[model samples]
Target: MGKSIRKISWVAFIASIFSFSWALGPSPLVFSSGNQKELWDELLKYKLWGRDALDFNNSNIHFTTVEGYAGTKKDFTLRNGNHIVNGHFVVGESFITDTGPHTFGDGYVRIGGDLVVTENAKNNTTFNDYVCVEGKEANPNNGVFKKGTPTLGSCPGFFPPLENDLDIPVLDLNKLSGTELADFNGGRTEHVNNGVLVIDGLPDNPEESRLKDIYIGELNINNNSTVLIHQNSSNNITRVFVNKFIYSDTEWDIKVSFDGETAIDDSTYAGTLLFYFHNGFTIPAGDRTLHGTYISNGDMILKDHLRMAGQLLSTSITIDADFNSEHFRYVPFDPPLVDPTAFANYILQEGIEGPQLINFELDRPAVIDVDLKYWFEVPTEEDVANYGEGLINANDLASGYPTSETNAKEVFFKKGQSKPTEEQTIVIIDDEFVEEFEILVLCVQIGVGASLPNGTTHQCFDLYIADDDIYLVPEVNEEFDFSVYENSEPKTVVGKVKATHEKNDSLTYAIVDGNELGTFSIDSNGQILVEKKENLDFESDLKQFVLVVEVSTIFNKKATTQVTINVLDVNEKPVFKKGADVVVDENSGEYFEEEWATERFSGSNELNNGKGQNENHPERPGEPQTFKFIVKYTDVR
Candidate 1:
């Protein structure tokens, strides 16, 4: 019954949030021993965590079901980020998209197994970040987000072997007064009232400090009697552990949250009440308003016309569904689930990003996972295989400023894996970046169950990181060959000198060489250009030139590179003046015929004589008188 209580919470929270029934509550109460008491308070760490979580606490493991849910934020800091679970979350009911779009995020969800949603969930869900399931998405067509699924791990949770142990501290209901019974609060819950086993909340224990559960018997709050769970500014939770069952017949609801900040001030808050039933629980028939996390070790049946902002965790959960009938709103644990570690009171750290390493020493070889807001409990070897390796969730996406950059992944240790060479395992975080201010990072859950000698089952921590960015030296290189016509327009850009600089430095450029012909130039932006295009000739003595440019940053770091410039040849068209008219006569083997001839033209030239006398086409006449000219002449000077 001990571990069963803890495991019960695992499946309990995921199976059903609010229901009033108990298939196992009474049996555990009768035979509840110290063993059963051990396994207490392991509410489905995330989405779900039980042998039969979200499985409707069925007779077997086949059918897991969920009717409604919510979680939509970007930061996992205050329970506003991704709500990741290592187990399977199943929704058995099928509702249409219009009455749908169940919100399970701030960011998104990353789980190991398949997230099977009933058919209706396909088009109705809104995911800020993709709901990544390593296994399979039964209705893959659902939700906007399907990115960032983890291939890291499966949640390792201890299943409640027997059931919740309700026989602890022997609650003796005989010596209790009406005021103490009606309004239960502090004190021990071990007393034997005459013969009947009733609770009086007064069994002496040396360490009667901090918070303890108020044990009450079978309670029926009918006739619209509202149960009030007290809450103060400093304390926002109250645990009520019952041995039998709790039933509410009227529309009045029970406050059932252990993390509600304003439960007492405003009835609207998830009240500081954790109503735990060792057997079963219910608000039979119809009830509209409820606030808190309802937990059970037995079966739970949900009625109609209900509106709640609480959580449901039970061994077996069943909700009566009707079209347009049920509504469940999600509000992060008001004060969220913090560390339950012995020394959770001492964990606030500060440091710089460096070659720093954090080492973990394991007592035995088992799976260990770093709970970066993604894991509620340490994940097992089985958990890793399902979700491979990826970012589990984001605290702020680390982009509250720019807002949408994902850069955090949940880490895990392999099960039965070999021991480390040094200690057991080591993790290092080294980032070089420039930041305006220090950043505070939060990893809400951190522990490896009993795997570590001094480890607790659960813990949380915060760390501040200082800015440490480094600037490197500047690098410059040669701007390669570029071609330009023999005559290009002055001030035309031929090529550009380029280089790399750090620290947002400004670089200036100047031509160090290339003036051998005084025809090349460079601008401040490193543009290579020509000053006098006419001076650059492919056939001239200066057919090619080398330009050496220098570039320096604001820090005065200098570098020079050689840029080769080649002048390209542009072909000039041949000029022709009306060649001396050629005359030819027919039969001019001896007859006169226009023939190509070389003659002095005052300049070097070659000409073709037109209108060759018709030697082939004996006689032909045309009004336009288009003539064919054939020229084969020698050079003339």
Candidate 2:
């Protein structure tokens, strides 16, 4: 019941002469081929066809002719296990090792068909005893094909067309101004002048031109320049789309790098970089190294001494350079090309037909019964919107939850059945709005029922019914600066946080952590106001504090941004200390006279002796009594 072992077959062809109809549901697939050539021709009609690696669990495959091929155009990799190919299993030339030549197909490969290597075969790894070539000559140059008994049957024969088409919005370079593009790079909008950006040679400041997920009509790199595509996170992929082409003068001169190093081979120097080209990609002449995946719709021309670690997928390839296999490795996780038209058509058509057919096949034979359980759902509008904004919580979506029931669908095989037909199909119907359906298949031995578990597997696919185009989250403007003088008037308008959504959608604004510190407040109009002026002291508080403002749509979808408020310090008047009573002996006239003279000279004579005659005081004794009087003074300012 392993998810990888499930064999979903598509009707490739029907017997040429005979045909039958089903009274109910869809009709079964039937094929009759006059020769192997006819069978191969029919199979090629499908976008994808053949047996997965898990199909060899209990049986061996036989490759009868050199032309007899099965599998996908995409690269297939075998990690560290012995895989059996009973008959002739012809695959595409792109088959290569995930590790190195010595580690490719580390396990045994037993074949039963007349081993034939096609012109497209291009592997140099040695299979050693791992491959038991039975019929034809097995050479290192052609590939390891050893003669062995056939255990597995022929390939699944037919497979459904891939859902390559998904309607993803493409960026229009002409519509976007240079300032918009620079904003995407987390740079000041004014860095790019006019509507175009040009780098004649190596940038004097590399940080000035760093960007990701942007569209460039034409990019020309000269004079040993470097272009970096930064990965948002370890798992997040960053892509740079070039509408026309990428031009460079020398091979190793114009280097392309990634922010993080390659996970393969534990290399500390190389990073991940992905470039998608609408046209061709010209590899410069000289020794060069590329670490990520390069996808092109047109042909890729490679020059001398090119070393790569990821993958290259194009309409065609032309190699004029020396490929260093030691440094070059294959990466299977490259993103596939999407056809939006096909995706829309598939969704519109399938939406009315309920659930399409899903086939389940066991890798190993067992006398068991299978039960289908609801696994999960996908294309959640909230999740999709959050993912676009880099706020997706993978754990929340992965938590086991039953999305929907099977709704009385027919199961080809039932409980208490022993080794049922391998080609049984199941009809799946779920909720209409659900864009993806995941189901878990549980296999239990006969008489055990559901008490004990034998094997469990799960599969998920997009229903493709969600209307993602219309459900857009608001876009909030980022980074606002609010300057204020220390001890300014209260209730002053600092700045406004602005955001926009669809024309018809209503929005409300609020500060995220507004209540934590009573420094600022925002109204529904996003007008930020100072609440307390006394708290805005430049010396006592930080020079700047960030305010996180969020704008939410009526439907609860929201976007957030940060604002910084700077406080400017101003000079203030000096303060004076209160004076205390001072007692001086009358005999100490010299000291008193000196102090009085100093205070008068300094213009700080705020002291008084009781001898002064005022309206409320009578004249003291003659010549001012020489008594020890108290002197009180305040510091002069």
Candidate 3:
């Protein structure tokens, strides 16, 4: 049991066209020491800095410094559209304008706390780079720190604290297991075991409460609740750990959405949302504009108009209304690096190479070469021979692949054959020479076999291949026999159901089972109207009603059919069955002997059975009625 080796340069990829399965495992926090100013002061001491306006990688938090404040209120302006802030700028009672006489952007401003100036404020503050007045000295006469130089003290910290710490793993809801509590109640959980999860109203089954990495212990969210995150894209990230507080009364009705694209446009950064609050984070009144990131360990009571583009860490931040940094834009906080379960089981375990082991210190026996690259985007030979039969219209595999490279058969091993031999590592790719691309980038390159000694080293692994199309399910066009005419008037169309799809007009009709017998209604162009003509009664409804309908498509693909309908039964106008209180008391008037009857209706009595030779009235049985008798009323003397 003596075999240890380590040498990998890099080249990893894993995109065999969509396939996901990662039962929660990374990100428990692991960054021992890469020291970037001590990891930016330990991410601003756990405020986790990484704001967004794009640039989501090298742990973003831009703003090397920017301070501007001009006076003489002429429309108090500080437009700045120049934007660039890597960190360091504190405006207290805000007022920095500029519409002429420039100099306000290009960065540099340090004012730790207190720069108040409100009596309807003014302006006269400018700084293209350099204006320091932290706390310890220099007040600069209430407000006048133009274009640079104003130094004094404080302002050189910007995030730094957890060098080698590790303790955020507590999630033992009684030691889980029951398939991990049914995969955390089947939302595939991310974290949340403590307690309080109140999202107030609406969720007996909102697609099973669509969740995602939500570690809770207290997370109310009232004010007409809403917390959807149905993401099928946008890199899918939705963490919401709240170890203590996250109240919410009316920030425009405690909302948080993604999928329905909650407003603010441009796919609102496609929703990456993270709201970690270890202690306090309330939302008193209304107004909000969130893209993502809002870590608060304590104190963040924002009221009224609270616009946040992203990243707003807090230990204390109370804005009662209007704090508009032009709609609050300070995005930065890149979170997503939690690999240490032996490097996530050597890159998501599957085959088992070297079965796990790495001590390093080899003086001889060393040969670990593992290469696996599967990048796709070339399918058009009739979509690789009609891949698996139907629905094929691909093209969107993350949008970058078409240089041409296809080599799917290679695997070798020596030095005790570091585990190969399953036909030297099976690798098949012959879907009729596959092509129709949209994304399938899987790169895995781990090399080291030139007689070791750091001679051959490589490491690369990337994965993203999603564009599996195959949807063709709309058909609807089977049983349909209409008759109508029971008072027919409501909408009247009745028959026209024809659904067939290859996305033809995108389909979309419905009546699914008579619609509670509201009498039918299909329409998205599948016609079939006649909704409720008093529920169409052929003798109190149901002469033979069936309906069903269905037919969807906009990608939801569905189909159903069955119409029936047969309500025909009209004709009814001959009635004289007595009882207006008949009384031959008009001076003994005759022909008043009570029972003045003439019945013949109940599905239109067979027709024709007269007694005066000039008659033809059996409830208008085929129309030929001619049995007359006139009478006028108003002789009550």
Candidate 4:
């Protein structure tokens, strides 16, 4: 690519650091052409032509026509009527020979005006080259900038004069609406007296659309008029050229605003806005505003001679001194895309919010929302209706389309109806309930080429989540168990249960019963043992009972057993009977048998004395004295 022809850095630095060339009024133009090489030969003949020539290979410029010396060229001056410099114009050495008092500046160079050569004793060649300058006029009308073909040391003389009879194209300003003008085709134009000049009409040709894409070239407004440009096309405006009146003592100015309004302060030009007049031209000195609107996806190329009085708020600015001899470049401004995570957090950090739409759908209708904070993407119904479903992806979520404020949420996808084979499914569960909830996640396998009894072709298994862990159902007890008796009391009983599904966790145990006869204790080893308590009632007549043992894992699982206790009986008390004698039969007084009737151990009164234990002394009849006896019974241990 050709190196972009911008103003020389040194020239710009000089122009910025010091003031020069004011004597020439404004900018002056001298056209030259003809197979570039031939034009350079003619230009080199001038005295005021620049002494420096570029060293580029296959060079087009042979000499700098702006340089010259005084006292070596003819003493020339300007006339009042129509004047033209048909050939190379330059000055000789001594810079000033036949002119009035002159001002010399650090970074300034003066050209134009008829050449004045000095006569000296040494150099005899009085006239070195030709030079022309506009006559000093009391009132210099704004000059005209004309375009023509190339020529050698001058503009093409054969070309027709500029179409001066042209009329300003007119349009109904009211017809243009919404800050946009269209349907133009270059057939109509709105003449702006003041304020902004916005050219939104369609180009005269679609090919021009390429030139206007994302940019509209700088507009040349009528005297005292301003232009504000923006574009939705592809081409970016590289520069702007203006033609206006040249005042010997005054300056030219302009301004620009990016989005309209008062975006920038006025800018000033050191020269006049005119292009003709080889000797008398002016560079603006005051300031003007540059109001422009930036394209979302384009850059700008600002030309030179445009100065900012206030702020240069823009993406960038560029200047060129050559192309069409203008100094203004403007282009569309584009904003940056934000990071998805940061964008999401910016939208959802404060509160529980619903899905947010991030981008727009093109072609088919679609809208997508993204929670970048959690890396979540959601598609709306509009998107599904237009783009089918699930068309929004991570990339789209990151774009945040439509507007920067997150209001525009629409976009399109190519094949929204197609299922994505690579996406992984996730099951969201509340972490807080993991301990108590018995969640059964069924793993359903759909067989490829099989049919079930019910005509379905699928199989499923249940997985139970218990004890803060996952397990398959239908587990069995597989641990070895040994039960030994210590003095007729139960000892340790050990075992382990195997789960159907292999899960990573440890077994836990709890004893469900202990007070009842059948209740037992289970240790951490999954062991069960009966507790022994002394002095427990063991009588058969007393109420008999048993112990019940229940064991299970941490989640209320249980395997049970019964423990029995035998009740036995022993003697508790004893009783004795008292002997009754024959005293009651005394009245009958039956004759006593031989030997004084000693009493048959039944202790009859006839053989007993007053003592409770009867020991017979004599037998007698009649008076019967009561004899008392006691019956006693004792409890045995």
Candidate 5:
């Protein structure tokens, strides 16, 4: 039966006013009020009739009344009434209150302004067409109509359509986290990469019987539902797992980048076009950081050890393969031509380090052995004809078959089982040897020296040596001579040597000294000296002399020492004679100085006016010619 539409009941108010008895009994009540005052009056009277059975039944009846600004205080004293309205119920803001716990028929009763009970009101469609039914067109007048009319009444033959009752608790996908969404045994449809799948929602305490099917469309997990991947269902029979997949329509292959977002399970995978994967997917090395793009999709099984270096944008990548044995035939078929040797070479040469490659071995001999088939490349027909068509037989692939040919070998891998080793040894070459050399030692000192009349003068030395062999002494030596009065110009010496035979070579020089005033040699046995002139001048005090001599060898090795020549003090002055033999004390200081002075005192008597002129005053003219006393002496120090 079509559920009848009803209004919000006023009996709730009736019960509130009459607390002690069941005045309106437990009958379905329908009430209407044009305004509030009349409604309250009728409710009061309904409560007053609660003392008797007849009154209770009579109150079970329904009633409705409307009054405008007439201000007529009419009271509705129904000895027995089911529903009643006694006041002017204004529209728009009128309200109904629930006085107590009341049970009514499934029929809905509404009191709001143009309200529809079932349809979700988040987006209002009823209010879009709401209009007031004036006094002449309300209820008994136009409210009742023939079947098929806009205001159609219920008809037995003309069946009234009814909507299915659905009271689904909406799940705020945004509110759930990845872990919280693990087991979703619900009646709602699930979202998969393909499209969607229907699922059942479990009862609060679900058993097999309580699992009800539900269909959902266009489902999306809320940000709060951070579960990128999760398995749903507690039972072992059926399990629902959800994973995130990126849908790309671009022509060129696109890679996914994960900034910081994560998927369920601590699994990592790379994604590509062919295989859907989870944690074992490959990703290009350089990509932007963002979530949502994953190289692979699907479930992943992690074994002993796994090392992935790419960006694991999404949940994980699954690697799943199974064999079909029922289709096997004994027909003599050429095994797929393959280069297992080359494959093995590739594995050993290009394989990534770590547990990237898995190997399986069994102790007992199996009934059959399984091997992968390979194809080799050929550039020409002659090459194919020369080498001939290389074919591998089933016997070559699987072993353990009866040698007698009675028993055939059936080779197949168990579901979810991986091949031990692909008959390939993988070796990753890492560190490389780069030839490098280091310099043991380096020193540079270039020297050039010349002998002069005054002394041997040499310029700053420049010598450098380097080699991977024995150390070589300087091939060039700088010498100096000074034995004449003419000024000698400075000479420079620069040279270097290289190591020989020995890996590391160093430069060492023999120590030498200067004994000749100006003649010197850089060799080990040489000596430098500054000769004293035939006639030398000295005055006042003792005069000290100093001279610098330098000695150097190969590799710029050098040593400097100061020589001294003291000239005795004598009362003499330097006299330069033209065209005469000139001499120079090469080791003496360039310039010289001496001190000489004389002290004298005189005494004299002046006139009586200047009697006894100050003896302390110095002799002056005229005024007194104050030459008191005089003494003189010549001294030199």
Candidate 6:
């Protein structure tokens, strides 16, 4: 069904009124309109674009997943009849062309950045009829080709078609750390680099169910791996977020998704699933096929041979294959257009590290369910912007709530047991990494089935969390340096690294750098030793070593320092090769000419150029034969 759009005249008003009356009484009207709702109208008309991609004169402005405004230029191309299909191509920039006979299919082109000829795209015949493929130099031929009135600015970023203030939840993969990313993505930091990832948002029978969101810390798409966006009888959407992107080589075909329903309402899968990457990644060349929209926050590399059945959007796309219909099929996405609503009910919460602290007082002596919501950001700004009002009372707020930056997610938001709960009691954890203080705010919201008399009607209670954990940073002793001659014994501790630590706090040492070749090791006692003794070559180009060590306390407070290890030089007397000069130091050792050491060692009778009797054979790996001689020199000093 085509959408009847709404305007954003009531969003701020809804956001402002979060008192108990609104939660227990009025529900926000479900109409399609907001900063992100414009997407539905534009997509229906084939308009996908970056912000400001159109000519400055266009009235319709759209936003994208990327932040800020990006003006358009001659950035993309339509070669042959590849993208000429039952779809439209919209970009933040304008369409590109060469002087050749390029064939464009039946699809429409809406340039978000710039319009070349601008005369309504030859009455919407093709992209070239409307947008200038050429840059600011002005296509003189545009006057002759263009035929219709000009229109612009049709595409934007991650806005869902339904109401809820474009709230698809813009979770930036680049900004969040691995620990934070895993919290939202199934509470896992590692998954599916080599195995199957089954995201079954829609289950077949009653035994099956739906999934909210899937997250991956770092996803390495490989040929041997399979990613199935499992289908369901209930029409639910599948969403996945990946923090880091990498490529791994394997020897097999990779499965991307199952039958993904093309549009939001449809249960059949013809096309239009999306694989959005925050960082740049690659689709390796193979005898495999993939379906979905490929959008990247950074540059993307498309290898050859993998057939695709969806649209692709990115900052820079490098197609390392033939641009034809057999390789790519342009299918735009159709998101569900409906109203999603929310309301507020209080759920007092504290961290689950110790005993649950926030005690609840029920108004009716009955336990009621409440909704718990969370987002990653500093609590102060987040509180004011999302939940709290202006400078008001602190006593009424979440007790031990952080007004200072010291207790923010940017500083000490650690890992804890954060999960879905319907109980009135909630837990907000303060991690051990928090240095100096531990504090945070846990906001409670009522949505869907929550009601009034269970809580916020005629009476409101002051919520307080009893917390007394003061965190501090761990301290480390100075770096220790020790000198060892070449061929030092492996597994022998050269020196110990000391650190001042609390009696209750345990310290761990790790060699962060200068041990890339697996030449060094550090144990629990901060003992530095050689893992590979052969690496300590005195004559090697590197004469000194600097080991950067990282030390962490039991509380997760960390500090780093360096250890310098210098190699002492060893002098070698010249061997008797014809007329080799043997330096005879009085205190050093006895020096012998070729005549005296003829039968000294067992390997060779004569010092044949100092081969030490083992000329063609090195006794050890790099070591020749051992040279033992008697002292025959007297001190002259």
Alpha-carbon TM-score of each model against the true structure: 0.31, 0.28, 0.24, 0.19, 0.15, 0.33
Span of ten consecutive residues with least summed lDDT in model 1: 72-81
Which predicted model would earn the best lDDT? 6
Give the per-residue Cα lDDT of candidate 1 at 289: 58
**TM-score, prediction 4:** 0.19
What C-alpha lDDT values do all the predictions have?
Answer: 0.39, 0.38, 0.39, 0.26, 0.22, 0.40
lDDT of 3 by residue, 1-637 (tens): 0011111111222222222212222243223335333333233222122111111111111232221111110111233232223223333222233222223455444443334332222333334456554443223443444544456555545311112231222234455445434543443322223321223212234343322555445444544444443333323345555555534465433223433444323223322455665555656656645656566555555554555545555444443433345444333332211111222222222123222221121222212222222222334546535443211223322233322345433333333233333332112222322222122222222221211111111122222221122145876667778889877898889788877765353677778675685777777888888877877756663677887888876545587888887888776454665444432232232342222345333221222221112333456565533333332222111
How well is each residue in 1-637 modelled by candidate 5, as lDDT tens digits?
A: 0111111122331232211101111011112223333332222211011110111112222212211100111111212112233222212211111111111221212122221212121111111111221112112221212222222222122211121110111233444444434433233333434222223323334332322222222233222122222112221111122233332221112211122133311111111101112223222222112111122222222211122211211122211111111111110000111111222221211113432221222222211222221111111344324432221112112233222213322223221223333332212222221111111111111011001111111111111111112122332223322232212223322111122212222334332333333332232333322233332224314243344444343324444444443445443332322322222233343332111122111212233321222332244433433233221222243
- Residues 85-137 of candidate 1: C-alpha lDDT, one tens digit per residue: 22223222221122243444433344444555445445545554434444555
Name the runs in model 3 displaced over 4 angstroms: 1-129, 134-147, 151-479, 482-499, 503-541, 544-548, 557-564, 567-637
The list of candidate 4 runs beyond 4 A from truth reads 1-100, 107-186, 200-210, 213-224, 231-235, 238-257, 261-637
Clashes of 1: 66
Candidate 2: Cα lDDT at 357: 28
Q: State the lDDT at 549 in candidate 3.
A: 81
Alpha carbon deviation, residue 555, candidate 3 (Å): 2.1
Candidate 1 vs candidate 5: the lDDT winner is 1
Candidate 3: count of backbone clashes, pairs at least 3 residues apart or interchain: 63
* Winner of 3 and 5 under lDDT: 3
Candidate RMSDs in Å, in order, are: 28.7, 27.3, 23.5, 35.9, 39.3, 24.4
The candidate with the higher TM-score, 1 or 3, is 1
lDDT tens digits by residue: candidate 6, 226-274: 6566543223334456667666655323223335422121112323244
Steric overlap count per candidate: 66, 20, 63, 93, 99, 29
For model 2, residues 1-637, the per-residue Cα lDDT tens digits are 1222121211111111121111111001112223433332233222112222211111111211111123432333432222222212233322333222222222233343333333233243334323433344333355532333222323222212221221112234344568645533334221221222322212233343222344455555544544443332212333455555544555432223222222222222122244556666768677666655465556566654455544554444444423344444332221111111222233212223333323332222221233323322333456445433212122223233344444322222332232233432223333323222222232212111111110111223322222232246788777777788876776888888878875446678888863466878888888888887767767664678777888886545778888888888766433323433344533344333324321211223233432322222246532434334344444332
Candidate 2 residue-wise lDDT at 52: 22
